[model samples]
Target: MRKLDKNLTETLRKTKYFLLDLDGTLYLENKPIGDMKNTLKFLRDKGKKLIYLTNNSSKGAHTYVEKLKNIGFYEEGDLVYSSGVATIEYLNRYYKGKSVCLLGTESYRQEMINGGINVVDGDRADVAVLSYDTELSYEKLCNFVRAIHFGATYIATHPDVNCPAEDVYLPDAGSFIKMIETALGYTPKVVIGKPNNIMGENLKAKFSENDDFSFMMVGDRLYTDIAFGKNCNFPTMLVLSGETTEDMIPSAEKQPDFILESFNDVKNYF
Candidate 1:
């Protein structure tokens, strides 16, 4: 593993946009990591643009904004972006206000509604958006199967199987998606989240004109967060705070540009 160094600070100082992960890199179990708020303030004070990159489609961007605000991160609306937002954007572009049925949390439904798309409760939808709904039920699965069988377009917010918390890992929306896929005999038409270009494209568009811009994706997951950055040809920082650990380094097919214990240690690189 590559250690954090002063050279990393120079590289970060040159970065115009900082793509950050929420769950593992900045917080754990709804609590901000040590010095995370201070670090964010420091970046903002330096006039560096920061965007919260998350694969957790269980909640919308507004929900995240509220959560962050409650936790003492005073961010404006544009600073937060979620997979839920990406899904809405995709649906709006292709379907153009089609009647959609969503198997997601309340926050996801709200996001769909905010995007001016109708959210049908049953299988009568024109398209079905599968997101991470922690309150998933067998009845909902039955409805999702029916919708897919009826030729409604199938979409997933993200393909994450599990999400890490402070206590233990929990079943993410992708696990439920697999169940529906097994019954339907095929996967969704598209998944809008990390390791995909949709989120990256949104980030790039938000921070346009990047002549001197460098990006570093800081997260704890190898497959999702790190892969997203590497796939986009951006530098990656793997912090040992949540899902990833030191022992898992050798098995990883892709490596990060730097590795630190947590966000607190990242300040040293600055």
Candidate 2:
């Protein structure tokens, strides 16, 4: 095996779970980046768990699973964990039994229901969850805003303003949050996704028995991915294959513990 710098090698060795961002981190749109399949397989071959973590809640985990598997990035034991799933974890633990008004895609709504959450229309909601609601409509927005005005606790799934695409960027959950703020002059009380600890807490719980398990967050976005690792108290690795470039590193507020040209490049340091 090729040996890396002491710290990088140690971080790689110690990390039992790698929380990976999907869009810009691993692949672009529908294709894997630079032998990504081989790199991930090498990690798993060494017994490292790969968790395809994403902030987009517009789709369910199965959707991502299908995408990853089709692209050959997925293996039998690998997992896809999304902000929507993490939000469900948060709701069950903190607001269990509460009527939740969700401004999200129908698939995500089903995910919440499957997690034992009581999904209600915004009019009757005791809590409102804002996710990447690709199915968002005027009626849904009005109801979600009204629920918050009526004292429903507001929570956002993530803070990403835009999502990367093969061509153009699309508005994400954070854009919706900003819209709500513009309309209601209020924001969510808690954001459940990246740069937050809820997802990290869920991971901790999932791997609780293994106290030796350390986490590492790898991605392309500095604010979301690197910041999340910092929030989760995990080592962070920034990859250049996505949104961020080498020039953007110096001015970034969230500096990663390691940097690489692309995620597949980790094999060099191993």
Q: For residue 32, what is the lDDT in candidate 1?
A: 88
Compose the digit string of candidate 2's lDDT tens values, residues 1-270.
223567898778888898999877888877788799999999999899999998889998889999999999989999999999999988988998999999999999998898999999647678999999999899998888888888889999989899877688899999999988887798989998898878888988987833423888999989889989888778899988988988999998879999888888788766
Candidates in order have lDDT scores of 0.81, 0.87
In terms of lDDT, the best-performing candidate is 2
lDDT of 1: 0.81
- Model 1 pairs whose backbones collide: none
TM-score of each: 0.90, 0.95
Q: Model 1, 178-206: lDDT tens per residue?
A: 87777657688888999776787767765
